[model samples]
Every structure is written in C-alpha cells, then in structure tokens.
Target: MHRMPTLSLPMYDINHQATLGLTSALTTLLQQRGVPAEVSWPQDLLPHWRDDQLLLSQTCGYPLVELLPDVQLVGTFLSSAQGCDGQRYRSWLVVRSADENLTLSDFRGRRAVCNSNDSHSGFNSLRYVIAPLAQDGKFFSATRFSGSHRQSLAALRAGEADIAAIDCITWALLRRNFPQELAGLEIIGETPLCAALPLITSAKTGAATLEKLRSALSELTSEKRYQDLLAESLISGFNVSDRAFYDEVREWKDRAAALGVTAL
Candidate 1:
C-alpha cells in the first residue's frame, strides 16, 4: 500500500453538513484518486497549522487570500446561492435582530460583527460599500469577531450583535436549510459582489497532480448523488479560478489603507 497525504478541513462545513460529508467518504475519494490525503475539519484558522503535508486548505473570503499566499486557488463560488463561478457573487447586510430596524445609517454607534478581521466579503467588501457613509468611529461604535460565519449569524439571532456583513453564499444556504431561523430578518442592501472562495493547492504539488485533482472536481457534480449533496449545501458547481483574480481584493485593501480604513 502507498502512503497518502493529508488535507485539513474546516469543521464548520462538516458540522453544518454543508458541502463535504463524513471523513470516511472524503478519504475514500482521495484514495481512489491516488492522492491518499487525510481531511481534518478543525475549528481554527488553517494557515496557523499549515504544514508540508497539506495539499489544500479551505478558508473564507479575505483570510484565505491573506493567510495562504502561496497555494493555487482551485474552486470559487458565490455566496448568494450562485454557483462556483463568480458571476453571481453578492453580499448582504443583516441586522442582528428583527426588532433592530436599523437603516444603513443606523450603523453609527452600533456594534458591527464580521466573520474575521481579514475577510473580504465580511470586511473588505463591506468596507467598500460603507466607505461613503461611514465616519471614523461613528459608523460602527464597536466591532466584534464571532469567529465563524455561523457564529456571526447566531450572534444576530441572539441579539448579541447589531449587524453583520454576511456572505450571500452562506446566507442563501441558511435560508434554504433553515428558513425558520431567518424568518424576520430583512436585507437592508447588497454590496458589490466580490470573488468567491477558491479551493487552493500548494505550488509544491506537481502540475499533473493538480490537473488530475481539477478534473475530479470538475466531474463531482456529474454524478447524481454528488450533485444532490452539493445542492443541499447550496453549491452550484465547481469552476477554475486563478490567483490574479484575488489581486483586486488586495488592491481594495490598499485603497482602504489610503483612506485610513487600514483595518480592512
């Protein structure tokens, strides 16, 4: 038997039964493809523990681009129920509770919650949308990190937060799976769509290996069962995305710095 490489996965995806399912199934798929890799869905930022054994790591909007600079981005998807292609990517500003009929102007002196400080859709993209209206400390009286997107959504549900910059992809998935959870909330507005999260690979891997992996992913939806699973997770399809696409996100970050919104 030949040895296989391991890939650490995010627990939120698995716990939510989002895209990927049980570890056994994932491992089997990898082994069948000749890349015996292990998948771990831990709850921490993957870049912190990234090692040579990691073939790929999953992360959200900005953190993925910031944290893993060397890996090759593989898959990209829109949050607002769009497919893997960036064509339909969108953003939504969600109020923490139904009673908080806060307008976009009401962001002032209120707490703002994001998935992470480095998230593009969660922070950078939102920054671009609010740049015109936000004043230094008035727009957001305070900011908090709910760690994961789910936590941020939960914070809104529990009234622990005032507003959250939610990715349209996750929001759509929640709306499909748990409509009751999002019963009273309203989308005040939408931000310009940013590039979707790309599934990435390290440069250390061989191009042939990468090609084979890409082919496998391309065909993931061809199988009926897999297609249904992805539909359940709100994934439209997998598509190829290059690193240059993320440069715009970097440029946005640079512009934010120029405006003293360096936190983005």
Candidate 2:
C-alpha cells in the first residue's frame, strides 16, 4: 500500500468552503472504512495533482488522460449542477444579458476568454464547439486567459471579454453561494457532455486501498445520513470511471486541432 501523506482535493474551488466542509466529512468516512486519509488543501495556485503522496483529488478531463495516465481513477462525481447528467458534465458558453439576442455566430471576431488553455471546460470544450464555425481557422478576434472560471466570469462582468465557457459545477456552486457574480450573465451556448472531473489517487496506491476508497465513496454518496452534506456540495452521487469514458474528450481536442481551432 502506498503511504498517503495527505488527501488534497478541491473539486470545485469557487465555493471552497463548501468543498472543505464536504471533504472533512468524507475524510471521516474514509477513516471509518479503514483508509485513514485526511483532507488537506493544495499548497500552490496550480496544484500538483500527480504528487505521489496524494490520496484523492479531482482533475479536468483533459489532463486526466493527457498528462496523468498513471494515476488511479477512483470515480466521477455525479454533480446536481444544471449541465451535469449523471457523472458527465459540459461547458456553458456564457455572455452578459445585454448580449442575449446574439447567438454563437454573432460572436465571430468577438473577444473570448477562458480559465486556461489546458482546461477542458474553459478551453477545449469551447474550441470544439467553435471549430465548425471558424473561418480561415479563426473565430474569436482575441483570446484572454483569466486563470479560473470565476475570473473568466469576472472578465465578462467587467466587459473585458464577450464570451467564456464555464464549467457547470462552478456555475452552480457560485450561483448557490454568491449570486452577485453572475447577476447579469446568461448562458448562450454549451458543448456536448463528456467525462467530467473524476476523483484520482496516486498510481502507487495498492489494490486493497483502492477498493477501500471506492467503498467509502459509494457509501458516502448513497446513504441517507450524508444527504444534506452531498446536496450542499452539489454532488448527487458517484459512478465508476473507466478510462474509455474520456475517448471523446480526446477526440474533441484532436478534432479542434485538426480544424486548426487552437486559439479559441
């Protein structure tokens, strides 16, 4: 069994306190199930998801297969968030209410913003949707990186950008906790649902401990005792994640690249 020094998982950081509260409860459940994992926070702005000592963490679909193939996929969180269906989720292309009459085609040559280039929800998904609409291998006149979903929303609020693709879970959490952030914003378009962020542990985790994690998470999601906690965190349940689930996500990335839609 790998020695799990800490469990660092902030699946949705917009309402980080809620995630913290839920994680604390989950850690207690893991311990009760003999995993003995303790919840901890990432030490840096960009989390080191590949850390050998990691017990469990959630990562975007893009990086899960592209960068961290060796990590053990525990399961996908079934979010109660609007764009979520079971364990799959999608990105919502959002614009201000002032632009409600405009459609995806109306945004051509418009300014675009995203959390980061590596982000599936913010970058990859948006690119995939816009690929077919791109002319001469371009769509948005300019692209901006806001560093996070909330920051991307901030850019739209301040008129720094016209459109941004935000993860639905982040949208739901912020809407529940801080409605002001999205006061004037409205979802205009969406990418197709694909594999969402799934909980992961280090590849070094042994089979026994892996089984313990699955059992604990299953109990946490299914039992009535933790219903309120799960609802507060916006997580509906959990589902088994086979790597095959991410095939289309990679295909989306490839399809965008083939259409030369990287800049969006």
Candidate 3:
C-alpha cells in the first residue's frame, strides 16, 4: 500500500497553533478531493522536502534556487501586508527605535543578527544591500544566527545584538499579533524586493498530483472558514510562479560575491 502523501509549512510555522489550524484545513480540503494528505513538521524541513513521500511544502527563495533539480516550484504565497506586492517581498534592516544616532552605516563594526545564512529575506537580501558598503567582505564586527526572524528581533530588543534583517511579512505579522515585542523597534533600511517563498513538491510528483495541489489552493479563498484561516496566517492567496522569478535572488548572491561580501 502507498504511504499517505505529506504536507508541511515549516517556513511560516512561527505561530504553532495557527499554522497547525491552517495546514489542517488545507489537508481536510485535499482529502475531500480524494487526495490523501497529512501534515508533518519535521525537525529539519530542508531535507524533508527531498523525501519521495513529500507532497507539498513552502521554502525560501535562496534554498529554492540553490536546491534546484531536487524540488519543483508549485506556487507562491501573496501576503496581505505592506512590503508585499503580489508574490514579491522585501526585508527590513531594523534597529531599536531608541538608537537615535544610528544609521545603516553606523551598523558597520557592530553586532548583527540574521535568521540563517541560507535565508533570502533574512541574510541574502541584507547582504545584497550591504555588499557595496562592505569593506574587505566584512561589515559587522561580529555576526550570529538567531535561527528565526522572531528571535533576531528579540536579540535586538534585549541588547544582545545591534541590528537584524527581518522578513517584512514576518515583521508585519509580529506587529499585528505581538505588538509588544516590536514596540521599540523600527525599520532603518529595506532591501530591494525579490520573489517571496514558493511552494514546492518533490520533483517526482506527477503532473496530475501537482494539478490537484494547485486546484486546492485556488479554492481556499472561496470558503469563509478557510478565508478566516488565511487571514490569521497573514496570507491573502497563492499564485502560479515562474521559474524565472527566483533568478533575481541568484543574481543578488552573485552580485554580493563580486563585492566580496559573500556570507553573513
């Protein structure tokens, strides 16, 4: 017997309760269409997508571009937030609002934090913006990984770090749901916009199965209950994404490398 197809949304699972609810609703909808689906939150989602049993998941543009030939783009999410226009999103270079004397240049030789080295909105976007300003491929006096945008914000707030690059969609959601956490933070700079995270299925997933997945996403907005879930998740809808859309991210990486600021 074939194992049930699995789906995961590890990238946007910051709000555990809400993510579970949203994915559960999607799973229910898929099952109703005779597509047996189950939700799984693996410890590390990057490797999980390579599983032949994988049916669906969302991944960052950097990984999506780097991990090509392993995963196939299925769709992209359009968030109902500022800094997001359709499937394009940007990153905000943020510092504590109280740091009145600081500017983007002032961040040089200071501590900086990012969600991960492989995150487009968290690291690559910020690197692309800072590359020209960077000297000898170096900008910050010290840099560290907080593992997620939310943590990066906290590190800045607690004085553990001087600044962070936050995904604008994550920042907007935190502003709406947890305003207290962001009360003293402000965006000091923004990176050029790039395609947002794209949904993916195993390269082995067949055309018919991919069509079923796309159909389910299109039907999400038509129902009131699912609409509510989408709002809670801060997602407006999904769109068919072109493979060329992520080329900008690859270009940014190459540009940064040329400037000698290849890693954060």
**Model 3, clash count?**
0
Candidate 3 to truth, TM: 0.95
* lDDT of each residue in 48-155, candidate 3, tens digit only: 878888899888999888866578788998998788888899998899988745778888888899999889988999888889889999988888899899899889
Highest lDDT, which number?
3
Better of 1 and 3 by lDDT: 3
Off by over 4 Å in 2: 1-4, 43-47
Q: Model 3 off-target regions past 4 Å?
A: none
* Cα lDDT tens digits for candidate 1, 1-264: 633455654522623564455334445566678876766554555642355455655555566567776666666643327422343365688884554566777676677788777777778876776665666723676778887667777777777777777777677666777676675566776776667776666657788768766676666644666765666666556667777777777777776666666652
State the C-alpha lDDT per candidate. 0.64, 0.85, 0.86
| Prediction RMSDs, each to the true structure | 3.2, 1.9, 1.6
Looking at candidate 3, the ten consecutive residues that score lowest on lDDT are 220-229
User: Candidate 1 vs candidate 2: which has greater lDDT?
Assistant: 2
How far in Å is the alpha carbon of 81 misplaced in model 2? 1.4
Model 1 error, position 53 (Å): 1.2
Worst 10-residue lDDT window for candidate 2 reads 38-47
- Comparing 2 with 3 on lDDT, the higher-scoring candidate is 3
